[model samples]
Target: MSARRTSRVLALWCPDWPAVAAAAAADLAPTRPVVVLHANRVVACSQLARSAGVRRGLRRREAQARCPDLYVARDDPDRDARLFEPVATAVDATVPGVEVLRPGLLVLAARGAARFFGSEEQAAEQLVDAVAATGVECRIGIADEMSTAVLAARRAALVAPGTGAQFLASLPVSELAVEPSLAGPERVDLVDLLHRLGLRRIGDFAALTPAEVASRFGVDAIAAHRCARAEPERAPAARPPAPDLTVEYPCDPPIDRIDAAAFAGRLLAVRLHDRLADAAVACTRLAVTAETAAGERLSRIWRCAEPLTPEGTADRVRWQLDGWLTQRALRGHHPDHDEWTGIATIGGQAERPGASRTRRTAPPNGSADNTVAPGRAVPAAPIVLLRLEPVEVVTAGALQLGLWGGEGEQEERFRRALVRVQGLLGGEAVLKGVLSGGRGPAERITLIALGDELSPAADPALPWPGRLPIPAPAVVLVDRPEVILESAAGAPVWITDRGLFTADPAHLRWGTKDWQVAAWSGPWPLDERWWSDGHADAVRAQILLRDDVMVLLLFGRDHIWHAEGLYD
Candidate 1:
């Protein structure tokens, strides 16, 4: 069988949807004048604002002059999709499947729905009615091609299967720029130029031969011309039905730490992908769901342009958890005052001011509750369960591979070797170093698993006042080692209270022996987080030992000397 579905498609579009979505999010009445702006120009205007002479493409000043009381919302892609998701879900209930072209528009197989509903008109009616019940207005159109269907829907009219071309020919060519499926920056420009050339109707554009159009206008224009002519659309080969691929993990001890959640997400992503690989499939869309200890549920579906590998899925899950945790932190009671029971310090001493002790709480379900130490900031809600569901699947073999003799095979072998090492050493034991943004040598690098998500240890983009001038050190000791800095006469070398070095020549001693410094550089001072309690004030000096070894020494705060790095 031909992999392509029938040419007939049904498109559903919500007119002025950005404006509608913004109004809904703000809980404003639909009759209230609203305008959505992008690049300081009106992108979408509500019916109320439209009546006041506000239309798309008008500059912000022009829009305000036309409608003095316009409630203008800045365009946000995430907000648009988040608000539109409910509408798509409502439509999916009536149609067996729906392909979302964008937030405001979608297309589906018309023949199957029409046959099931008894007629194309009835199918469109059912879809329109379903979306309307969600409190958003929609118009549906059925035509033989997706592009034509989009225009037909704007008019709320269905074109007979074979008459899509005739129906589209009468529409203005400007409508081509309005169809999201067919319109892009280039195609929009083409439409404008076509209007200048007096090809004002789809009929005029469709009259040009495909070859001539391709030769002169380029690829996107050729696609638009084909749509104008109602040419057949050849979809990729159909895959088998999605498998019952779902993986769930119970957080026996609810997870409240963002780092803990990220680790768990990575493991779950790996397991989920392994299961799909066993079934000879790959995931295109993934649904992540989490249940909080308070019985609240959070779920989101993430779609990928390419099949989501374990790393990509893990990253998405981690990002979602971060957002949820951040929001909870912002809205919930002060976490710094929470009665956390356990204290787990990673690599450094407790820098923040406070002493906390851990206490174990027994729950009715017999699960151990692991809470942070009291008087420490933490996520307000702990996740009790995490679930991963593969929403869309594709045949694994269908994914294109690199050409033969390419590094693809070598890379696969290298990955397999790393996996074997991980299996031997335990999952978290074997790690790969990843560079992150940071001014300090120790803070700029992090370690993660070979196939796990990569995130920065510290944001390098922030203004760091006391950053050391680089030529970064080749070797950074994982732990800062306490040392003693002394002058030639055995007097302690120190940075004066005025942020100046006490002496010129210096010797360093860590254990029992002392190393004479052959040459040294001035102390570069840094004071960080001065506005907060427990502020750090330190000075670093580079020393070249007589043994031809170079090292960096830090002095300040508690008057302690520590070896920060080495040039080894």
Candidate 2:
């Protein structure tokens, strides 16, 4: 124990981070336990839930079977983070600088603060109570070292200084945070090795020599050895929080369909953008929150491109939400219920670990936006993202807030609503296209024009490295060039060869008939250079061009005529 480093650690695991997060966020009194599933997959189980025999690693179905009443929520680590930021900030205020373990953990150097606040017991209670005000219910553990504090927080059992080794000794070997003993049947496990070594618990492992553990377990052994004797956990982070940002829209006209949920998400995003601008923070998390009148709430979170911005943030949230909502989703066989629930109350947050509150959104009232020249682009800045959250609930009906006949219900409101209607009535919809950039094969290029939008159109805004030839033509000839026509007078009718040969026109010919000069126009003829590929580079400039009449770059040998656009 003397050889091990000392630490003041605090691990606050709320059994389930997301449920507490959602409960803290909404007006609903949280009676049900919430479990945040990572992409509908289980991550952490709540304390209340654990009492039901539901464990963290168990699958949703398995856990449900164990504790049929467990409220299985999705694991949105990012959402949990976004929701947790303010709470963390509150913690930092209480103890200046602390290390964030994750969305659910934080280890603070509390030796001085504990003394300054009067006592260890007093500080922990004050700290927990202060954070709880942010809507998240948290627990605290004060120890001389980190790993021990983690265990203390976990077991809600604390240990005094110089007693970390004893604290660790009492914990089960499985509590050392090693990989599961069984990862399928083929892979051998540490539990077997520990058993073979005659080590039954973490405390027993503490008695082994560090050199011996290193010989057996390699680098990870260093951490395990430190944990066994109660040491300060080495944080493998350069800085605290990763930068990310997300904006959400709660509900519009507010109802049951995914579309309404998506529509409200846009407005929430815009509002969040405005607030973030004033705060000078850019993040990469986009979260959505949905609430059902029946009290069920669902949320979703995501990551985006680097060097995030308000515009880029808005663009992504709109696109992704639209993709999921506008498209119909077939609900798995509950046959009787046909109506979909909607979203409500969207929020935005930044996710920058160790974010100091001093950063400003815009430049000071009179100062420049950045050091860049006044007319040029501003230098890119750093980002701080809040966790992203999304909620979708199976509600009874849309809430109608009458405003002398405002937008009506979020789903069915009329003419100027935020969402585009897709059912019975037809309207010129504002659709999206993934416009492909550059030029090569027409199949590989794009430019958003008029008419309807489709999938293959390729969004021009996305990064595209390969494009077409330089000085690309503005237009190309189409409709398979009109069949060349000539007149009876052997003077080569229709369009004359009028080229480098001379400025002349004798007679004209068209579709097996000859016509005396009605109004002779151009003798614009071009021939390929001797060294050139025939007709490939043969558009040798000519003056005879007209508006109404087409100067067909006719191909005899291989002349590919491109109409080169119209004059009018």
Candidate 3:
């Protein structure tokens, strides 16, 4: 058998989509500088914000500092997907078989559409116009592979067939990390490592032999290597999934509510994942189908660059169900209606020609009824059954599970447990600690809710003048307790303005307890916010007691000594 050629894919990308969704949801003016943040880091910013030096990964404080008038919004994946449905619907109307890579990105086979529209360029223009009609701006790219097409979409370029490799040749290796929603975010680190190894360009990395990349990097890098070479993401061994692998869930009362649909989708996704795992295979392309009470069948195919994990599978199902239910809700009246209007605005921008064909009105109950154009058929009833079928499967080796019973298995189990607990207790119930910049132990740590982006409050790489030495305290006290450090002469020990100790520390007393100081380390003074009225002047020291217990003590300008932390 000869080698299989890469498929021609068309990718549509909406830049700064999170910012756009946020602005539309908040009804912010188009000229306003907007940023959407996750875990206190700027994940997406509007064009206005970008012009002000705001970029992804910037700390919230810094982003705001760069643009003081920036309007900040939390990242809401549901909102992004919900608002993007019309755009996707518009594209689906223009060309069938649209595969959603994520909320703001879409991909499909370009051959048929190109032929129908007379050329690839024409199809790209038509798709762009379709999306723009719904009040959103988009860029389209056509290439021989989905990954290549995604990158091209960022530049609005079209790569001629069989020339994907040459087209990607001079692009920076960092391009591998672009559109993280399509390719995983793990590519960011891979790109950095590639740069350090002098593989600055995509072609340089692609030039390496497969065996070389396999020996030097992990599974992700190997997948990226294939992409760099403009090859298919799946290995040639990919086969059709077994018929028995299909999983389905029947909704008792039929699910019309978005929350209910989300719950049902998760259950079905887990079941499908378990079956795939049992079969020792992983799904690369998933077919999500839903049957409504009116016998209406809705189906969509989602293609992933990486094998679908349970979370990824669940997310796709939820998005599809949400899109289906939202479209139903938007239509407001009976699905049998043939006329409706398009969305009025996206990212707070006015709709273009062919936009605003639908007018959303409030029902008697005073709630808004969101409706979209009647281009695609809407389900006439609530969804009664949800099914998942693996359209394409590959051996589970792609998942990189640990050999036998190893750390990978253990880590996966542990992560599942955390997710379970989080599901039961709400997203903020569980917390994880992230290292951040500060002079004191407590200030150096930031507690973030699990499932959020683990961004530190400050950059740890920056120099902290009065930071504690090599080993951090084992325990940082949330409440500072008053203590007394005195000399053998029975006078309170103090640090002079010149930074000299008035006397050698002899004893320590706190709450009816006392200990003799065996040895002590001197005052590391910190004058924080000295230029402002909230300025604080403090000195900290490490003290060892006769009992072998160690304590971190601080003396503030209040002339009070407080125990700050304890060392094990």
Candidate 4:
């Protein structure tokens, strides 16, 4: 087994940084009460505002009512991230290998700095002094693991060696929910479930074995349990050299959906992977870039533990595109916007749009505010170009021999045959079903090239509410055939506004034939993508016929019914 790459961690935290940054930008006194809001709710508040019961997550009116003089500013994540860069640079000058968790939070390899400063306590004091020079209040904590270090930083305590788990033991179970690193609906629900199960503390949840946690709660919970037990994740390995070849795809009219980009991404990934395979190398770091029609470019670099598979590469491309598109759409910043897509303009340095254009909402601090107004449509920027460049590559290793080597050989043979076919026909012609996790039956399956690896097309760990229960359809039809549900009196059945059935479904009709219903269930309604302007909101229901055929039906806002899928 490989040796563990564990190291002591030091965390630096700046409290209510959004409020602080906003207040500072406004040239307000440090004693003034300020609160930063998002979605009309208070997300960050100054100490003075907090003292007046203007807490985080409170509505704006409630917060203002509590502190009548509280200065309210809209939440701008770009502003927070930009302003925090200097603090990060300052910390890096004092201690190397700093990892920023978010704008207000960061952790560093503490052992070297502690040794340099003669002790961890002295190191923390020096770090605090360094940040204080920037006029921001900072706290420090040192512990054996990142999560424990973050918690300790919150309380401004240094946990002793081999005692991080013990230090975390007394913290409330809800700490897992509030962890900025693990913020998501899934983590929140898991913590809530633990509370309902009488596990009210981190120690209580950590007492269970990893196997038990994995079996019952899934992979995400196991990750949290590891953190609670003070286990440090494996450190990242050193990077390798970049590949010589870079693949690019240009869209003519541009595309809207991420799935459309993913299709092109898969083809490019295979081409890149094949070249690396010929050179007997594997990619470790992939750089994905997408350019909008209006010349704005978006790029991100992803580093993985192992070599990149075709599906893995495609997945990263899809994820990065999703993040960029969602950010632009939600903030009402199209590629054609005069300013940058996500960055805040400083000191009149931002480029201005043409004379014949719309004036954006510019905040007093000389930054553009991209918050979408209520009922305003999110602009759909077309993706015109995609480029996949390998940032790091390593030597491919020999496969480990096992007793099931014959099966491995068979799989290799199949892969070779598919590749040969792909060389003849286009990549899209050689298709295979890849499972994608989602609430809707049609959305759960994705089609990719035949020889590509089967990575998760979507996050299965997500708490997909209203997803169909198990005994999943055996034969999900690829071509969704249109069908109609009829009542006992031969009239079409319709769903009511309250989601109730207008009449009992007694028959199902295809083009010319009608099938009698033996036994049936559902009309379990599902709503999806209501907020996005690109896709219309859809509602769907699943029904089981007496003939034992299971089918999924969809209802649009226009009340038209269509067959979504057929179960095996």
Question: Would you list the C-alpha lDDT of every candidate in the order shown?
Answer: 0.70, 0.45, 0.79, 0.68
In the order shown, the candidates' Cα RMSDs to the true structure are 21.0, 22.7, 10.9, 17.0
Writing each residue's lDDT as its tens digit, candidate 1 over 281-362 gives 8776676777877665656556453566777678777765654554444335453545532221111112233423333243
Candidate 3 lDDT for residue 472: 81
The number of residue pairs in model 3 that clash at the backbone is 5
Q: Give the lDDT ranking, best first.
A: 3, 1, 4, 2
Cα error, candidate 2, residue 551 (Å): 75
| TM-scores of all candidate predictions against the true structure | 0.48, 0.40, 0.68, 0.53
Ten contiguous residues minimizing lDDT sum, candidate 2 = 375-384
Scored by lDDT, the top model is 3
- Is 1 or 2 the stronger prediction by lDDT? 1
Residue pairs with clashing backbones, model 4: 475-568
Cα-lDDT of candidate 4: 0.68
Better of 1 and 2 by TM-score: 1
Pairs clashing in candidate 3?
Answer: 330-370, 330-371, 341-357, 341-358, 342-358
Point out the higher-scoring one by TM-score: 2 or 4: 4
